[model samples]
Target: MNDFPWLSVLIALPLVGAVAVALLPRDRETLAKQAAFGISAVVGVLAIVMATGFDSDGARFQFTETHWWIKQFGVHWALGVDGIALTLILLSVVLVPLVILASWSDAERSGGVDGAPPKGSVKTYFALILALEAAMIGVFAATDVFLFYVFFEAMLIPVYFIIGFYGGPQRSYAAVKFLLYSLFGGLLMLVSVIWLFPLSAKPVGEGGLGHGTFLFTELNTMHVDPTTAKWLFLGFFVAFAIKAPMVPVHTWLPDAAQQSPAGALVLIVGVLDKVGTYGMLRFCLELFPGAAKWATPVVLALAVVSVIYGAVLAIGQVDLKRLVAYTSVSHFGFIVLGVFAMTTAGQSGAALYMINHGFATGALFLLVGFMIVRRRSARISDFGGVQKKAPVLAGLFLIAGLAGLSMPGLSPFVSEFMVLAGTFTRHRVPAIIATFGVVLAAIYILWMYQRTMGGPVREGNESILDLTAREKWAVGPIIAVIIAMGVYPQPVLNIINPSVHHTLARLDRPDPAAKIHVAEKVAENGARP
Candidate 1:
C-alpha cells in the first residue's frame, strides 16, 4: 500500500500514541504506560522491517516519500532512508522501547515516597518520551533542511522537562545549562541556514547563480565556494560540535547526565547527541565539501584533544553517572575524529561507533540508575563487593563498562580501531596522539571497575539483589547485539560503504581538471586494490 509509506508511519505512530495518552484519564497510568510501550514496539517492528527490506546492493534512498511542504519557501516535505539514516533510525526506534521498559519499574517506584510519580506525572512522562521518539525519527529521516532543523530543535523541549522536573538534586541547574548551550549552538546554525537556503535555491546551471532550493538532492548539485561554504559550515559545525560535546563545548553534558533520570539521560546522550555528528555527515559535508576539506586538519586536532581531555577527566570522576558521561565525551571525540578524517573506514566506524556507544553507554546509565535506586547514592565509593550478592547485575555492569572502554572482541573495539586506522591514513600525528586515548580509556574503565566491583562488601551491599529476570531481559539483548555487531559488521559496513564512497567521490572532485588529474594518477599507479 503506497509502497509502505514507512517514513510517515515512523513519524506518525508515536505522535498519535502521544495524543491518545493525553486523552486518557489521568488515573489510567498503567494503560498509559502500556500504550506508550505498544506504540514504540510497533514502530520498532516497522523499523526492523524497513531494515530487513533494505536493499544492500541498491545503495540509494529507498521507500522515499516526498511532497511539497512550503511552496512559498521552496522546502519540500521530503523523508527517506539511506544506509546511514536507516541504521540510526532503527537504533532510535529500538532504544525507545528499551527505555520505556527500563523506566517502567522506576516510574512506578518514583513518587513522594509512595512509589508513584506525582499525580499525572507518569502520563506526561510517557507522552513526552513517545513524542521525543517521533521527533528523533523525523530528524534522521528528514531530507529537507528546514524539516531537519524543526525536528532538531523540537527535541530539546521534552528533555529539558524530563531533567528539570524529574531529575536529581541539581536537575534544574543542569537543565538550564543544557538548554542554554544547545540554544546558543542552534541559533548560530539558524542564522547560517537562512543564508544557505537561497544559495542552495540558485539555478543549478548558472555557476554564479544558485538553485534556490532547500531539498538535499537539489543542494547536492550546487557547487558552493570555499569561503562562503566555510561560514555556512560553521553554522552547522558549531551546533554539531557542542552536541557532539567536543572539547571546549562539552561542559554541559556531565552535569546533565548526572542530574537527569536514567531514561532521559539515555535518550538525550545516546540518541539526540548523535544528531550533531550525523548533521555533519548529512548536511555540512554533503553541502559544503570544500569547507569540510579545509577544516579537516583543525577538526582532527580538536578531536584528539577531546579524546585525551575527556578520558583524563573521566579517570578523575567520583560520581558514577558523571564518569559515564565523561566517557561519552571521549567516545564522541573518536566519533568526530573518524568523521572528519573523511575516510571510508573512518565514516563507517564513526557510524558504527554511534550505534555501539548508545547501547554500551545507555546500559551503563541504566545500571547506575538501578544502583542509585537501590542504595540511593550515585558515588562510586558507595558501591563495593556487590558482586558477591548481585552477580548478575555486577556482571552486566562489567560487560557494559568493559565495552564502553573498548575491550577487544566487543563492538566498540572494532569501530574504535577502524577510526584510528582511518585517521592515520590522512592525519598521522593526530592519529598517534589519539591512540594514547585508548590507553587512557583502559585506565579509567579498569579503575572504575576495580573501585566499584572490588574490595570488601560494604555494610549495605550484602543485601543487594542480583538482576531480576526483567532487568536481565532488558540488558541481555543489548549485550547480545553488541557482540553480534562486533563479530559480523558486514551488513552495516556494506550499507555504509556506498554512501561513504559517494561522499568521498564528491570531495575528490573539486573541479573537473582536478578530478581528471586524480583519476589519471590513480590509474597510473594501477590502483592499490
Candidate 2:
C-alpha cells in the first residue's frame, strides 16, 4: 500500500469518471448523473481507506510520490499528505458524493424561477463537477509548490462554468466577479512562485537550494532575506485572503452563492474556499515564518472584522442563499484567526474547524435549498410556519442551524471552542472581540428560524411536503457526524496534533505561555544573590 500511488489514483479516478460521463450520449442525462455519483462515491471510499492507513503519529508527509514534471525549472509532480492536508482532503472527498446526490434531481430542473429548461447538457454539468473534485484533491495533496499553484488555478475553471452556465439570472456577473478576483490573486501568487525558484536554485552548501526543487521538503530548508520574504509573503497572503474571501474581497461570495446551484455552492463554500486558509498554513506560515509573525497583528484585525461584519450582514439578508454566504465569511474569519494565532492548539483547532464548517455550512445550504425548491422562491419572507407543514425538514434545519451557531454538543461547537480558547491564551483582546461574533451568530440563526419556520403555517407553506427519502439520505450522515464529532473530537485531534507541532516548530514561535515562563525564569536568576 505504501508504494501504491494512492494519491495519484485518488486524483485521477474522478477525471476518468468525468471522461466516461462526457463520452456517453449527450441525451443520456440519467446515465451521466449516475456515473458521476458512482465515481465520487468510489473516490470517497478510497479516501477513507487512505485515512485509516495514514500514520496519525507521524508529522512528516506520508504516501509521498515525486517525479520530475518540469526539470527545466526543477519542479516535480510531487504529492503527499500531512495531518492538515489529509483533514481537508477528507472533507473534500466526503462532500463531493453528497453534493452529487443532492444535485441528482436539481440538475434536471429548469435554470431559474419561471425560466425555461436548463440551457446546458446535464452530462456537461456532472462532468464539470467530477473534474472539480479531481482538482480539489490535487490542491490538498500536492507537495510541490508549482504543482500546488497549477491545481489552485485550474480549480477556478469548472467552478466558473458551474456558476455561469447553471446559475441564476445574475450568474454571468457573479461568475465574472469570482474569476477576476481569483485570477488576480493567482497572478500575484505566480509572481511569488517565480521569485522563489531562483532563490531555491542555489546549492544548500552555499545556503541555497538543497535539491534545486519546488518540493516543499526541499524549499522548507531554503532561507530568504527578511525583506524579500516579506514581499513574497504578501504576494501569497493577498491571494489567499481574497480566496478566503475576507471582508472587502468577500463581496463576490454572496453574489456567487446566490447565483449558483445549491449543490455546487456546497463545494464552493465548503471545500474551494478552504484553499485560502489551507494555503495560509501551508505556504504563508510554513515558507515565510518571519513574515507571518510580522503580519500577525494586521491579519488578526481583519479576521476579527470579518467575523463581526459577516454576521451583521447575514442578519440583514433577505435572500436565503445570500444569507448563508455571508455567514461563511464569518466562519472563515474564525478559521483565519485560528491559523494565525501561531499556537499548536490554535492551528489544530483551525484545521478541525475547516472540516466541521464544511459539514455545518453544507447542511445549511442544502436544507435552505430544499425550502426554496418547495416554495419556488429564495426569499426568507416567503417562508413562515414551514415547520407546521414539514416538521421533519424543520427539525433537520434546526440541527444544521444549531451546528452553525456553534451550539453545544454539535461538531462546530467543539472546534469553535478550541479556536476561542486557543486564541484567548495568545491574544486576549482579539479573542474577546471574536466571542461577540458568536453572540451575533445566535441572533441571526434564531431570527432566521423564527421568520422561516416558526409561527402559524403561512398560506403558501401549508401545502409544502416534508423531506423525501433522497433528502433524508443527503442529510442523515451529516447530522450523525456532527453529533459524533462533537462528542468525540479526539479522533480528529489525534491526527491533527503532530502536524500542528511540526508547523509551530517550523515557525520557531514559542507558545505565549512558554515565553512568559522563560521571562519569569530569567528575572528570578537576575535577582539571585
Candidate 3:
C-alpha cells in the first residue's frame, strides 16, 4: 500500500474520465451525464479504498510517495495524507459523484446567460466536473508546495466556465468576480512559494539549506528569521483567507452562489471553500509558528466578525441560493475559530467541522436547486406551502437547513459544539461571542425555510413536485450520513485528533491543564480545618 501511488491514481482517474467524457459524441447529453457520474463514482470508491487503508495510529503521513520533480529548485512530486487531509480528500471525492447525480439534467435546463447563448456544451460541463475533481484531489494530496500551487491555480478554469457560461443572468459578472479574487490570492501565494526555493537553498547560518529540500517535512526543519517568516505567513494567510472567504475578502462567495447551479455549488461552497481553512492548518501555522501566534488575536477577531456578519446578512437575503452562501460564510467562521484556538479539541473540531459542513451545505444547495427547478425562481417570496405538495423535498430541505443551524442529532451539531467547547477552553471571549452565531443561524436557516417551504400552498407552488427517484438517490445518502455521524462521531474523531496533535506539536503548544476552582480556593486559604 505504501509503495502504490494512491494519490496519483486518484488524480489520474478523474483526468482520464474527463477526457473520455469530452471525447464522446457531443450531442449525446444523457450519455455524457451517465459517463461523468459513473467515473466520479469510481473515483469516490477508490478514495474510500484509500481511506480504509489509512491507519489512525500509524505514521503522521501515510501512503507516502516522493520523487524529484524540479531538482534545480528543490521541488518534488510529493504526495501523502495526514488525518486532516484524508478527511478533506474523502469529503471532496464523495461529494463529486453526488453532485453529478443531482446535476444529471441541469445542464440541459440552463438558459442563456444574460441573453447570451451558453458558450460550453453539455458534455463540456460534465468534463469540467471531472477535471475539477482531479485538480481538487491533487491540491489536497500534494505535499510539494509547487505541486499544490499548480493544482490550486488549475481549479479556477473549470469553475470560471461553469459559472460564466452555465449559471444565471448575472453569471458573467459573478464568474469574473470569483476569478479576480481567486487570482489575486493565488498571485500572493505564488510569490510566497517562489520565495521558499531560494530560502531553502541559502546557507544554514542564514536559515537555509537543510539539504535544499522543498518537501514539507524538510521545509519544516528550516530556521528562517522572524521578519522573513512573517512576510511569508502573511502571503499565505491572505491567499487562504480570501479562499476561506473570510470577511472583507469574502464578498466573492454570495455573488458566485447566486449565479451558480446547485450541483456545482455542492463542490464549490461545500468542499472547495475548505481548501482555505485547510491551508491555514497545513501551511500557515506549521511553517511559521511565531507569525501564527502574532496573528492569532486578529484572526480570532475576524472569525467572530464573520460569524455574526454572515448570519445577520443571511437574515436579509431574499434569494435562496445567496442565503445559503452567507450561512456557509458563517459556518467557515466556526471552522477557523476552532483552528486557531490552539487546543487539541479546537483544531480537531475544526477539521471535523469541515466534513460536516460539506454534507449539510451540499444537501441544502441541492434541495434548494430542486425547488428552483420546479418554479424557475430562486426567490424566497416565490415559494410557499411546498410541504403540502412535496413533503419529501420540504422534509429534506428542513433537515439540511437544521443541520446548517447545527441542530442536535445532525452531524454539524457535534462539530460545532466541539469547536465552541474547544475554543471556550482556550479563548473564552471569542467562543462566547461565537455562540450567538448559533442563535443567529437559527434565525437565518429557519426563516429561509419558512419563507420557502412552510407557507400555505402559494398560487405557483400548487404544482410543485416532490423529489424524483434520482434526486432522492442523490441527496438521501448525505442526510443519512449527517444523522449517523452526529449520533456517533468517534470514528471520524479518531482519524482527525492525531493530525490536530501533530499541528499543535509544530507550534510546541499543548492542551491547557484543567483549572479547578476548588483547588485554587483551598490553596489560597490553608485548607478547610
Per-residue lDDT over 114-195 for candidate 1, one digit per residue giving the tens place of the 0 to 100 score: 2324333778888889999999999999988888888989999888887776776677788899999999999988888778
Cα RMSDs, all models: 5.0, 5.5, 5.1
Report lDDT per candidate.
Answer: 0.81, 0.88, 0.88
Poorest lDDT segment (10 consecutive residues) of candidate 3:
520-529
> Cα lDDT of model 2 overall?
0.88
lDDT of 2 by residue, 37-87 (tens): 899999999989988889987647899999989788888999999988998
TM-score of candidate 1 to 2 decimals: 0.93
Against the true structure, candidate 3 has what lDDT? 0.88
As a whole number from 0 to 100, the lDDT of residue 378 in candidate 1 is 78
Model 3 alpha-carbon drift over 4 Å, by segment: 111-117, 202-211, 515-529
The TM-scores, one per candidate, come to 0.93, 0.95, 0.95
Cα misplacement distance, residue 251 of candidate 3 (Å): 0.6
- Which wins on lDDT, candidate 1 or candidate 3? 3
